[model samples]
Target: MQDKTNNQESSLTRRDFIKTAAIGAGAAAIVSMSLTEGQSQTQPAEAPKTQPSATPLKLEDVLKKAREKLYPRCRVCPECDGRACSGEVPGMGGIGSGKSFHNNYDSLAKIQLKMKTFHDVKKPDTSITLWGHKLAVPILSAATGGVTYNMGLKGKMTDEEYIDALLGGCIKAGTIGMAADGIGDPLDIYEIRLKAVAKYNGKAIATIKPKTQEEIIKRIRMIEKAGGLAFAVDIDSAGRAARALPGQTVEPKTMKQLKELAQCTKLPFIIKGIMTVEEAEMAVECGAAGIVVSNHGGRVLDHTPGSADVLAPIADKVKGKIVIFVDGGIRYGADVLKMLALGADAVLVGRPLLRGAVGGGQDGVALLINKMKNELVDSMVLTGTADVKKVKRDILIV
Candidate 1:
């Protein structure tokens, strides 16, 4: 009786149901008019069927739609200048004044590739062997994360899901993937990510934040256990004084401390966040297997020169001494080629790969990588460069 009473209180009448259906589905009622008025009522002509386009939507087009629907913090803009997202340090923006972020883009833009012709070159080989792993291209996805803080939860992807797409996608595309360590993230997160990475035959690399020596060493041990090919530490993260987790500390390392850490690890130890020539020299001196010319993606400090502007000097000084990799403002394959000409053995792509992984998963990442590779090849052919390994300095319009 009580259930009957509740049903009766909210019951819908037949008229109400019809009205609701009409309102909900936009049902058009064809009421029969008075038959006497127009006995010979003519039927309406049939509408023509629209044909679907023969060409399918490209992966980039699909990614554009996914960007709108899934990604929250990042809009995946056509151009990723710092203007749309400024002073967004804890997230994706730069620190303090946002000048550092702007500098990365501006400095890279200042470099112009001198076009050339009249050389017998077909397709340039764009492969490089790093840390005993041969990559299809001289490009790899930079270590990027913080889906909750950096990209946002609305991306409809978990940290694990994102990393799976990122690392897995890169590996599938014939390259390496770099996994990131978040300050706020728990330790187990790294374990889960590395477990996923193991399927790629340890081609995926990992980067640790500048945690304390004990913490850094502990994490390095974990990476070693995970069958990782190499590991890196972003020392520039020390500038992020405002965002460190409680009980976590990031400090500058002395030469002795760096050598100690270097000696402890058997893996190819890479030191990221080298901005100036001095730091680049110091990194090699400390027994680094490789050094990344980066400004922490301009997230650590404000008003620093972009990695591109300083890359040539660093490369000239330590080109053969230590393997040189660079990141920042690398939007396309042309940019990748530019970095190679300026003096980078390889380049790390950050946000674009994130968007690719979020939008189309493995396929999306592979497509983006292919796009960059295609563009790099096109740039190489036009410049009459036969081999990617021997990209001449003269090709650059310094």
Candidate 2:
């Protein structure tokens, strides 16, 4: 058998040789003096000839490094004045037309600028006290259904494991986990999350689908008994079936019905998918504790304004009367800051969590959240804000 270590050493270039030598020397010294067995073993046997100095890395640094490694230069085509044009290169494949706001780097740059300003502004207290539980951050894992179906990783994530991971990650991140109804039987999902919450000491927000007032009431009672912190109904999806999955129906709940449901649950009642001020006021009239200004991630309605677009108006209308949350196309910590600046109490993430789940299971999910949180803190520090609550609207241009 060939010696793998010898082969590795032989394959090292001159630069690698110098780097390894320096690293090895430093590692050997540290190992020799260190008492910890694990720490000592991590050091290389040979002294390194050229190694970089040991610099402590903050979470923000790690995330920045990761971002640089993961997302390269902006490859998407620049959108010209109102024309939908597709630009394709030989090796890069086809990139979508820049006509969509999401596809435009300039729009993203503006959002980033606003985010930085918000971060520089006084940091708002990110701590939130809702449903009798105090959370470290206002962000929540929005109730997103069909994740397993969409990702085609059903067998990879067991029901218990998935629930446990979601609950655990949420707790670790100091946020609440919101689970959508109709992913499975309501009672079964409730029970699974109940166990996860108890075990992880986490909070859960169960979103019941639109149903008859009586059924809604029953589900609310069940959620309360199951020890959930909040109850919600995704009103935007009501009376509609997902185009991705035609079998899944989202029956819309009326204001009267929502009011009755709110009255039934002792837990905080949140109404998801309020796109307009009219709907937001109705949610308040229906006695909602919070309103999530969402557009179902553009999965429900095409060509609708992004959630960020409507957040300010809705926040202005509701003022201080209700807790405001928003979700849609939030992929970074700066995005979270932008939403908060726009009057969102916090922002919810959906697809990112799913991506994390697919890529790394529970630990991957944790990594994804930790990365986001670190980015958020970095944004805060760079903008001169000390905490989450101090983030304000004046920090934004639009």
Best by lDDT: 1
TM-scores, all models, native as reference: 0.83, 0.69
Whole-model Cα lDDT of every candidate shown, in order: 0.76, 0.58
lDDT for each residue of candidate 2 in 190-244, tens digit (9 for 90 to 100): 5665676556543678787765566677777767766777887887656254432
Q: How accurate is candidate 2 locally (lDDT)?
A: 0.58
Residue 130 Cα positional deviation in candidate 1, in Å, after optimal superposition? 0.7
- Per-residue C-alpha lDDT of model 1 across residues 1-398, encoded as one tens digit per residue: 99996686469764344334334323332222111111111100111122333343255554564455333355555577675567886666777787888888888777788788788787678888887777888889999878777876544678788888888777656788899987767888777788767766677888988888899999888888888999999888876546666876777788988898899989988999999999899988999999999987888878898888999999999998899999987988888988998899999998778877876675467667767887888899888887777888888776
- Tell me the TM-score of model 1: 0.83
Per-candidate count of clashing residue pairs (backbone under 3 Å)? 0, 21
Measured on C-alpha atoms, candidate 1 has an lDDT of 0.76
Quote the positional error of residue 208 for candidate 2 in Å.
1.1
Worst 10 residues of 1 by lDDT: 35-44
